[model samples]
Structure formats: C-alpha cells, structure tokens
Target: MSSRDPSLSPTLRLRARGALANETGRFETERREAFDDGWDLPEEERLLRTEVRIERPRSALTYNRSPDLPFDRSVNPYRGCEHGCIYCFARPSHAYLNLSPGLDFETRLIARPGIAAVLERELRARSYRAAPIALGTNTDPYQPIEATHRLMREILEVLAAFRHPVAITTKGTLIERDLDLLAPMAAEGLLRVGLSVTTLDPNLSRRLEPRAPSPARRLQTIRRLAEAGVPVRAMIAPVIPGLTDSELDRLLAATAGAGAVAASWIVLRLPREVAPLLRAWAEEHYPDRAAKMLARIREIHGGRDYDPAFGKRMRGEGIWADLIARRFRLAAARHGLDRAQPPLRSDLFRPPPRPGDQLSLL
Candidate 1:
C-alpha cells in the first residue's frame, strides 16, 4: 500500500483537539492535525488511504452487562473504523490501544486477523453458552477494510456451523458480499440485520461519513438484503437535532420505500473524545448551523455534550429530543414501520463440539 502524504495546500491548516495523544497517552497538542478545507483532499491524503494493522485479542466475546443494550455478547473484528464517520461513538476506543481518537481513529486501524479461529475455539468450549452475538455494535465490522480481511465472513461460517444466532448492524454496502451466508441463516431465523442510514443527502453524507457507502447505495443494500429474504431493520441513527432531524419523515419514507421492514432512531451522542471531534466537524462542515446544532444537543443533554445514562444516552432528555422522538414516532407509525420485528432465535444455538470429542451420532 502506498503511504498517505500529508496535505500541502497553503490554505490548509491543522485543527487540534484533546483527543490527539501519542503512544504514551500524554496529551500534547503537537500530535494533532486536520484540514479545514471542507472539501475532498487529493487522493494521496484523503484519510481513507489507511493501512490496516493486525492484533489478536485473547478472547473475542465482549460480554456487555449494560441493561440498555439488547444483546449480552458482541464481537468486534476490528478497531477504528475506516468509514471515518465523524460522529462515531466508537472513536474513543482507540485510546485503549495507545492511539489518538482523532485522525488516528480513521487512519490507523487494527484488525484481528485470526479472530474467527479464536471465536470458534471459544464457542466450542464447554462453558460457552450462545445468545445472539451482535456484530458492528462498536466499530463497523463491514468497514471498507473487510473487503480484504473477510473476518466477518469467517465468523459467520462459525456461527452457521454451531447454529448460533446473530444480529448485525452496519453502514457498509460490503455486507452484500456475505448474502450467501446471511440468506440461509435468515431462512432459519438465525440472523437479522440493521442498516444504519444517518441521512439521505449525498452531500451531507459525504461530509459526515467520508468513506461509508452513499445513502442511495445503502438503500440499495437494504433492498437487496430484503430480496434475499434477510430480515432487515432500518436504523436512522444519531438523528442530528438541528441538522438531519428535519428530514426524519422523508428519510423514513425513502428507506421504507426501499424495503426496510422495521425502523428505529437514536439522538446524536457525543461521548468521550467524540464530543470534541464532532465539535471540530461541526465547525468545519456546518459552521452556520453548528452553534444551533450543538446548542440543541446540549439542551437535550442537560447542558452537556452527551449524557451516558442508560436510556437517556440513547434518546437524550429534553424538549428537542422529545420533539424528534415524536416526529419519528408519528412518521414510523404512519408508515407502519413502528412495529417491532421478531428477534433472532437463541434457542437454535448449540455449543460447538469440543476438540478431541466424538462426533454426535444422533
């Protein structure tokens, strides 16, 4: 892979944030930089030109006891998303690897090259119990890099072998590549997918999520999955208050038209490092409405950029949130998208046979 060159435009200047820190985790402003051009940079420095690094986790199942989450166990095949969605809540996770959550969160990626084998071993362990394993709950598993890594596919093969149920959420059109695995799994009620479409405007989408699939492409992905008999739910996530909230009904209508069976939405969240990154993004892209957007978000968050309190974190707490919620509620109801689809079957899961064990003769 060719190395990405730093921008050389005379008008270009770096925007620094507290999220930038070296491997030592020491906060130094010099380590941070960003281009305020607000337009696409040259291909050599587009930020998506990142080389993936591989890391192995001792275990793959990240057990979540949070009552707010729907699944108990989830797996992330990679860290730091290539999609470069400026509002990603997963950005802060980069700090754990001694990396910056700013540019590094997009450019510096870590993949678990052998995660599928590890997952298979864990699933075959006697103590293992299967529930619906959620993919893309944190960093997107189907991010652009998955084209070569194919970790999600390997993991899916393991899930299919053990009759394990799974739920996936992603914004990548790349998920379409796995339809063969997902279609059969969906037939058995063992799989369901949630495609998150934050906005329908291609221009807004490009600024908000530089490398993710175009909104229209995502709509096509949903249609394809639906046609393949895969259960699909449209996720209108992080509904940016003063920005995308106005499009709530239209986005829902369009997605529903494209074949989404059910729908859900979450208010914008700016937790940890994400708050500063989003503030920077707002300053860069939506300068005119940036103040209004941040203010509205703060209003919903009780004068904070974000509130991580269980249900409040997902939806937020004030009139703005309520209004958005109401609009989404009415829209979903009117469109008949308010209905909850059935959950994937957990009872179908059977622990994989352990090594050195006799094959079942039943």
Candidate 2:
C-alpha cells in the first residue's frame, strides 16, 4: 500500500483509514509504540489493516436493567464496529478485551458467527419468554463484513421462523438486502427500524463517521424501508452541541420527506476514553471552535465530560439540551413525525422444534 503523507492532520488521518492511532486498550498490561529508527519509510506503508477475529459467544442475548433504555435485551452480532465513528460511545467497550478504544476498536473487529444458532437455542429454552430483541444497539450488525458473514440474515431467519418481534437500528444501507425477510415480518408488526443520520454535510459526515453510509444513503434506506411497509424512525443521534446540532431541523425534514414516520435525538456523549479521543479529533479538525464545542458539551454534561446518570445521559441536562429537545419536538410535529408506532407483538412467538425432535401430532 502507498504511504499516506505524515503531514496530514489527525482528522484527515482518521478519514484516510478510520482511526488516528492504534493506542493500546486500557485493560492491557503492556503497551507499544513506533518511532523513527533512522530507516525513513512512508507512513502510508505502515497503515493499519483491519483484522477480524471470529468469536463463538456462549450467549446471544445481553440483558440490561437500565431504566432509561427502551428495550431490556439486545443482541450484538459483532464487536468493535468498522463504521469507526470517532465519537462512538461503544468504543470504551473494547477495554474489556484488552484492546484500545481508539484505532484498535475500529480495525481489530470481532464477529460472532454462531450468533444465530445460539439465539435459536436460547429462544427455544422452556423458560424463554419472548420480547422484542434489539439489534445494532452496540455495534452496527450490517457493517461491511456482514455481506460475507451473513450472520444477521441468519438471525433474522430464526426470528422469522419463531415469529418473534425485533427492533433494529443502523446506518448501513446493507439492511435493504434483507427486505424480503423484514417486509413480511414488519407486516405482522414484528419489526421496526431506526436509521441514524448524524449530519447532512457530506464532508462532515465523511470526517466524523468515516466508514458509515453517507447522509443521503441513510435517508434512502429509510425511504426504502418505509415503502416496504416497515415502521421507520429517523434518529439524529449524538447531536453534537455546536457542531451538528444546528442541522437538526434540516436532517429531520429530509428523513421525513424520505418517509420516516417518527424521529428522535441523543446529545453527544463522551464517556471514558472517548472524551480524549473526541477532544483530539476536534482539535485536529476544528481547532478554532474546538474549545467552544467542548465548553458547550460540558455545559450540557453538568461541567463534566459525561454524566452516566439514568434518563439524563441520553438527552443531557441543561438549557442547551432543553433547547435542542424543544427544536426537535417542533420539527417533528411540523413534519407530522410525532405519532408513535404501537409496540411490537410478542404473543406470536413460538419456538421452532429442535432437530430430531418428534413431529407435532397436530
């Protein structure tokens, strides 16, 4: 591979290939770094390559008791998203595996190939009670690799066979490939989808999210899903206070025009290692306004980098947050996006028969 010019800014470095540096994960007991050893080589030659490791998790469902979340359980088909959004709140999760929440979080991905089998096994348990299982809550299931792995599609097949309800959130246009499954399940009120559109500016979206689909593509995905009879919601998440917050009305308007039936927003959050990561990104990309941007974030975060407190964390707490909320509400109302779709039904759930089990007498 050709070497990238070392003189490029950090934001440009990320835009070049997803992350600025391969910092060691926080849980790692050892660390390493590179230095000039007198053999001058181009930086592009040293560009990090993405490596995916297959993980066979014993369980598929991750249950949570967090009061602020709308769902109680979620399924992550992959760990370490390739979408590589610099401000991803899920980045810190890499620490558990002794991986850096920076570059390593994006480049060194983990795929659970057996997720569908495990999900089926769990769903068939005698004690299992069906509820809407959430997908793409931590990482995008439709990330680039899914095209080859096809785990998400298999999981959907199991859900469809069992007639279980599901909810998904994603920015990947790849989800459209599964409309044959999603459309029919949605017709039964067993599925809903939310597409996150962070910003409408193509250049800004490229720099911030790096590998995720462009704003235009996401809007198209929403339109496609809505046309297929799937309930679609447009999510303007991590609404950066001074950065992308100004685009809220326009983003909502565009998605609504594309056929979204509901909308929501979450203020930008910088938790754990993500705080410094975002700070570095801002200084590199928007030096003049970096301080002002962070100051506004602090103002909403109650003078801290973040507040993990329930309910308040997602929406934040302060005048600026309140203002954003009011603006979103008004825009949604104006676009007739205030109506809520009914809850997905769990009553239709039925466990598929185990292999080699006796055939039902009926």
Top lDDT: which candidate number? 2
Model 2 spans > 4 angstroms off: 1-15, 38-44, 359-362
Question: Deviation in angstroms for 135 in model 1?
Answer: 0.3
What clash pairs does model 2 have? 3-44, 4-44, 25-99, 25-100
lDDT tens digits by residue: candidate 1, 1-362: 21112332334322321222222223433443435657766534232247689897789889988988999999999999878888889888887777777667877889998898899888877888778999999989998889998999899989998889999999999999999899999999999999999999998888788888899999999999999999889999989988899999998998888888899998888988788778767776667898988999999998999999888999998788888889999999988799988878878887666679789889
Top TM-score model: 2
Q: How do the predictions measure up, each by TM-score?
A: 0.88, 0.94
* Candidate 2 TM-score versus the reference: 0.94
Which parts of model 1 are misplaced by more than 4 Å?
Answer: 1-48, 351-357
RMSD of 1: 5.8
C-alpha lDDT score of every prediction, in listed order: 0.83, 0.88
